[model samples]
Target: MTTAAMRVPVTRGYRFEWVKLVSQWRIRLVVLACWVAPALFVAGVSQQATLPVDTLFGRWMHATAWAGPLVLLGFAGQWALPLLTSLVAGDVFAAEDRLGTWRHLLVAVRSPRRIFVAKALASLTVILLMVTGLFVSSTAGGLLAVGDRPLVGLDGHLLATGDAAGRVALAWLCALAPTLALAGIGLLGSVALGRSPMGLLLPAVFALAIELAQMLPLPVAVRLALPGYNWNGLFTSPMQLRSVLISVVAGLIWALTATALAYLIFVRRDFTNLNHDGSARRAVLAGALPLIALGAATVVVLAVAGLGAGSGIGQDKVQRSLATAFAHLYRVQTGQLNRPDVTEAQLGASAACTRGGGQTDPEGPGNDWRCVVSWRLPDTTAVGSAIYQLDITPDGRFVADGDGPKEVNGYFLVRTPAGDAPNPLWQFDGTVELLPKG
Candidate 1:
């Protein structure tokens, strides 16, 4: 007379969970928003006259359609990726408790592990869809609105349309690694907090903390271990294998460790209490302060890190990088001047860069980096020297100003035939590689 045990396949749980997820208006809205946001950004950027010069690929916004996706990629790395991951992963588990439905779901499934796996798969599927939608939308919108012109590469060279498109696509794919790591963090928060709002808030707070840590004077090895560093290689010209390797390894470690902890806790934690008496309100109130406090802390860190990533500049690398970067930019300037064609090879550039007015062995990041750059222009045997003042980031990005006034090759808004524009030589941007070269 006993009822036959309900025979259910594990994949059925996934199917059920996925249906629940897709049925939610909020979930649909999130996916739609991700797709629309990038396209909207592209449209807005296409209409704008001024460039977001400091943002990655920003200075090239009006110059090429490809800048649209890359600029958005940079913004996503700063915070959007974490926000999106948390929006889904942070709520997937906790929402069950918030609705007091965990017990019902457990009763039907008879296995907590099965339910966990189902929910996780559902969450990850949604995330993949959202990321893919945003990427494709951005690429399509940029090409439509801005036109598929060649892109300005990081080294100040022009990248062909096909090459730029491939790089942009690859950059988005590389971005997925850090995003998975973030999802793991959000997952643990959802399980531990057991309140949907708190779960979401927790990952936001965690991401802010990591952002602050990145601004600290951490070692390259330590910094590379953080999920955010994975995006840096995306900006490299040919892309660096070391960056991809680090991204995969670091992201995997974080995802596995955090997800393992979440799994253990989820499988064992008691759901008997079902009593959420005033817990949601309390969690909300409690989480509010942390978010505010962390946001403030992040701002403070940015201001300080803006001073420098803890004097991490290396003399030899800075010297070599500045010289090479200058030669590239010099070629750009010559082209703009309508001069005879100049090749990067013709600018045999060398630099004797020193730090802190020789007070320190060019060993750290600072505003006081000085380089006496010597380069021979085409048809000139004479090596001309130009003084450059550099503000270098620990990660090797720099904004360098040529010494003296505009007439002496100092970079002011140069008078171009089109109009006054950023002097390609005056205060141009560049970066140095922190990773070992092949």
Candidate 2:
């Protein structure tokens, strides 16, 4: 071979990959799907006057243009994001192997490293462009279909339009990291399996598996370990900076690990590994089953560990616990966390807990217990009492609801903190002060 033909510059490899990628119909289909899907989703949603309360920003989408991008993102992350990324990334090495073109590439390219890097660049470029297309199309369609009003936050507070838009943009930027992680997964599957279909299928299945694991009643730490675990932090009230940062770091780690592992395997494996009847392909495919089994085993271990330990309780202790919980809850709502009136016994607090008809197992699963609590209102001479419904979990966390305090309505209650506690003393899910309606 001529020296001029043998020396393939770095840029030439990348440019060649780009040309091959654009020449395929998959890239075009992905781009068209990205723009068209968002438009259709917005159109269908606009037809219904009702907001999608199930999804993040579904309610906000009816009024705020900023919500459009967020809503689109929320839905896309579920499945579309994985599939779109895999469509391009998954095909990188697998398609070439399927068509028996890797040998030709090996002869044409100076090094396998160049080919791998070029394929990765092409895949990353595809994902970025597709995501940008979706974001822009969704945002434009949302503004035209919905009004550009202020968005209602997760806390039911209104956020400024400019601020909400800025946040939406920032959220999209943060989302790119997770997209890269999914692409990495796709690339790994492509290189390992050397089949186009498996490349596309594995990443989506991997995403679905991680998502399902996250939804299980696992410990916070275990859940956080899953992919895309903290991606929703962007849509959370006040924007969960800590979770977002965690997601960014976790995503980068996942992407780097998967990509590095794929590169290592690809570099060592013989070119014949890409063949259908090769021993390498048979060994790799057979090895997949054990890896899958190991993954399943890991999930089972996590689930069991996450469950922790909880003991059964009798009704008497349940009543006593409710009474104590109510007293602390009242003190918390009244802003007397440090006072002697309740905790120090300078004054008295009382509660009567029951489960109707003199039931024995008030704290039993699926049973709703009732409690009538009495405590003096803050800075008031008279005492206030109200009936409340308590739902106690197996783990002892309970939610108390009633006509509520004279000044404010609380949704839940938490255990009292010890001296110099690190976290907040109160852990109410939400609260609304009483307001007189005309």
For TM-score, the strongest prediction is 1
lDDT of 1 by residue, 2-24 (tens): 22256346789889988998899
Lowest lDDT block of 10, candidate 2: 429-438
What lDDT does candidate 1 reach at residue 146? 81
TM-score of 1: 0.85
Model 2, global lDDT: 0.62
lDDT of 2 by residue, 1-438 (tens): 875567677688888888888788868877887877786677568657676745556655655677778878877887888888778887788888778888888888858877888889877887888999888888877777776777644333346788777777888887787778788888888887776476667778888887776544444334434457344434334454654675576677667767876777677668865454223463255444544444455445534644212223345555544444455444443342343444514225566777754565453433366767666644569866766665554323344555455233332232234432211112221111111111
Cα error, residue 31 of model 1, in Å, equals: 1.6
The lDDT for every candidate, in the order shown, is 0.73, 0.62
Q: For every model in order, what is the number of clashing pairs? A: 4, 0
Model 2 regions more than 4 Å off:
1-5, 235-238, 272-438
Our model 1 lands, by Cα RMSD against the true structure, at 6.3
Model 2 pairs whose backbones collide? none
Q: What does the lDDT read for residue 12 in candidate 2?
A: 83
